[model samples]
Target: MNAVEIQTHARKLYDAHGTKALAEAAQMVRELEQRGEKKLVEDWRRIQSALQQMRGPNVS
Candidate 1:
């Protein structure tokens, strides 16, 4: 997905799942990597990064 599409999907995910969306994205990344889905893994990593940016830095 393009940057815009990634951001849009990230926003939708955040809206639907809140902070849990980050975990969901991370899970997807891991699964994709294990499946050898390089392209999808890259996209999901982008989604995960976007989620982190949306959630801001970890406090603890």
Candidate 2:
């Protein structure tokens, strides 16, 4: 799949399963890494970082 497709799938998986989805997404990223898909991995890292920020403790 292309970057967009991988991103969309990752987002949906993240929403549906929270961090539990990371295993699958990370697997995809690892495959992409092996295939030299740098941009896609960068985008995936951004998405993962965003999700982690969203789940951070609230300061109030």
**Which prediction has the highest lDDT against the true structure?**
1
Q: 1-60 in candidate 2: lDDT tens per residue?
A: 555665676678788988677666667678889999998888776656555555677678
Worst 10 residues of 2 by lDDT: 46-55
Candidate 2 segments whose C-alpha is farther than 4 A from its true place: 1-11, 57-60
Best by TM-score: 1
Compose the digit string of candidate 1's lDDT tens values, residues 1-60. Answer: 999999999999999998799998999899999999999999999999988888897798
* Model 1: lDDT of residue 14: 95
Error of 1 at 4 (Å): 0.4
Candidate 2: the clashing residue pairs are none
Off by over 4 Å in 1: none
Candidate 2 lDDT: 0.70
